[model samples]
Target chain A: GAGVSQSPSNKVTEKGKDVELRCDPISGHTALYWYRQRLGQGLEFLIYFQGNSAPDKSGLPSDRFSAERTGESVSTLTIQRTQQEDSAVYLCASSLTGAAANNQPQHFGDGTRLSIL
Target chain B: LAKTTQPISMDSYEGQEVNITCSHNNIATNDYITWYQQFPSQGPRFIIQGYKTKVTNEVASLFIPADRKSSTLSLPRVSLSDTAVYYCLVGVGLNDYKLSFGAGTTVTVRA
Candidate 1:
């Protein structure tokens, strides 16, 4: 795709249910990132992936949240036993390079709005 | 990661030059200042970035002092369409560092 894309623009699931959000980064982009934005709040970093190397999972809020990326393309963010506090917009972004470089601008996706009932 | 502080909101009229400033008291030496604009229900878009002094692009201008403790994003002749949330980020130039977006400065451009 020409830009980063996310699936299921909106999802509403009951509390305690599991959910999965997907992201398709721009072709050739080696770095991918995930973030969460609560209502009327700034974006919160979740995780990052640089190619096939070990991902930076330091930002995941808890053990219930996990993510995976295949090669350098599609990625999925999975939340087990979702809680109401987990409701937010899940945003995905991709950059041409990894964290070492300072000039690559990250292209973002529209994000998936997740609602926990 | 360096933390940034910016205004929560600002009001402006059309054709006015809006300048939003961000303060990063503990900014790192290698960190660069970048600004992004995000509209309602949409993802943020990169506007401008700078290391030191001043840098201007087609969208906006980034002004950083020699101390690099703070930076400002200047939007010239802002239109109604420019109304959005502007975030000031400090990081090592777009790698995978955790981007801590403080409550962005919401600029409301009225006609």
Candidate 2:
């Protein structure tokens, strides 16, 4: 892809239902990140992936929030049994390399706006 | 992560130089100051970054003082299109660490 891409720009699901958000990062990008932004709030870190390395899942809000990345390409953020509080804009970003590279900026996607009814 | 503080909003006339400052009182030695601009319903776009002193790019300039306690994002001669929310972030690393976005300063460039 030309840049980080996310699917289903908007999603609305009832409470207790499940939702999946997808991200397609730029080619050759080794670092992928997921963030959540609630209404009128700052962006909250969710997870990060670098190549085949173990992902950092420390930011996932709860057990219901989980994410997976295949190699260094596409990533999926799955929210099980969604709650009203889970509604937010899920953003995905990718960088050329890891933290050691100072110039690599994290390019972001338009994001998926999830609404949990 | 170093916590950052910035203004919530600002208003400017077109063709004005707008400077938005962000304070990071506890910035670490290894942290870098980065700025991002976000439009409505869109993701943030990187503007410029700096480790110390001043760094300039085509879009903006980042001025970090010697103490690194605070930094300012200078948008030169901003136009109506430059009206957006600007974020100041301090990150420990380029990749792994989370870049926290505080209540960004919304710059409304009036025509």
Candidate 3:
């Protein structure tokens, strides 16, 4: 409960279906990030939100992938018309400060494991 | 963003000191090096971070040489529970939010 919390730890869906993964960051963290980790691979950054500033969505793979953060409390990553390649562990992390501060480390949640069939 | 390279895997025994090295030849002046560990089904957990010189925390030690071109993550008296995938990331203060985490090194601690 103290750490970052993610919902629906596991989800299985059809290839054409849509799914939303939620993340609740630490109480006062101002920076939030979303990442995707495929099996036997490294994490791929999806999006980043720093306070109320515009989100950095450069890492988004396509138009179908989008994310949003409500202030600094909760964030959600959505995938529309998901494909089999969309299957992976969606991770959420939060930091006290944005990436501009190198010393601040990001705390991560266990993540939501999504399987697209 | 600087590119980082680490070993594919390593094997160590309990009570031994495991040192995993990462190379970042084109690191920038403002880039900081950070390490994270991940278990089978969990997100990465921060291990340690350093800009230059050496930094030590309860979980691990991060050693960065003067050139800042390479870093080593040292785990002392490692136990079987230390077995996991370790990632070395090279960017944080470069104003680049999308930090790259190349395929990490898998360290297996044996009894």
Candidate 4:
């Protein structure tokens, strides 16, 4: 894709249900990231992937929040047993490589607005 | 992660220059300052970054002082389309790309 792409721009799910958000990073970009933004709040880092290295999941809020990246292209963020508090916009970004990659700036997607009722 | 503090909101007018300042008292020596802009319903886009002194790009300019405890983002000739949330962040500039965004300064550019 020309830029980062996210699937299901919006998602409404019931409590206790599961949801998956997908992201397709720009071609040739070796770094990918996921973030969560609550209403009127700043973005919270969730995870990051650099090439074939193990993903850095230190920012995942809880056990219910998990993510996986396939190779260096597509990634998925899954939320288990959705709760009302989980409603927010999930954003995805990709850069040429992880930080200090010649000051490579991250490009973000439109994001998926997930709502749990 | 270095903790950053910025205004909750700001108001500006078209054709005027807007400057948003951020303070990071505990920033590490190896950290670099970066800024991002985000419109409603869209993801953040990187604007400018700098280590010290001044760095300017076509979209924005970043000014950092000698102390490195604070930095400023300057937007010249603002337009309504420039209305968006601006975020300032400090990172190690190392291989780790994890970002922790504080409550951004929402800039409302009116016509």
Report iRMS (Å) of candidate 3.
1.7
What does candidate 3's lDDT look like per residue over A25-102, in tens digits? 999999998888898777798888898554588889999998888866899889999999999999999889897786
Identify the leading candidate in terms of TM-score. Answer: 3
Q: Candidate 2: misplaced stretches above 4 Å?
A: A100-103, B94-96
What clash pairs does model 3 have? Answer: none
User: What is the TM-score of each predicted model, taking all chains together?
Assistant: 0.89, 0.90, 0.91, 0.87
Report the lDDT tens digits of candidate 2 across residue range B42-98: 888878889999999899888988999999999999899999999888874844367
Tell me the tens digit of each residue's lDDT in model 4 across B1-111: 678899999999999999999999998877878898888888888788888999998998888999999999999999999999898888736753776676799999998
Give the CAPRI rating of model 4: medium
lDDT of 1 at A14: 100
| lDDT by residue (tens digit), candidate 1, A60-117 | 9999999999977999999999999999999998889888887677778989999999
lDDT of 3 at B46: 85
lDDT of candidate 3 over B1-111, digit per residue (tens): 678899999999999999999999999887888899988898888899899999999988999999999999999999999999899988776376665667799999999
Model 3 chain A scores worst on lDDT over the 10 consecutive residues at: A50-59
The DockQ value obtained for model 1 is 0.54
Model 1 C-alpha lDDT versus the unseen true structure: 0.88
2 against 4, candidate with superior TM-score: 2
Off by over 4 Å in 1: B93-96
What does candidate 1's lDDT look like per residue over B4-91, in tens digits? Answer: 8999999999999999999999987778778888988888887887889999999999999899999999999999999999998887
Q: Which run of 10 residues does model 1 chain A get worst, by summed lDDT?
A: A50-59
Instruction: For candidate 4, write residues A3-52 as lDDT tens digits.
Output: 89999899999999999999999999988889998987777888888874
Candidate 2 structure quality by residue, lDDT tens digits, A77-116: 9999999999889999888887677657788999999998
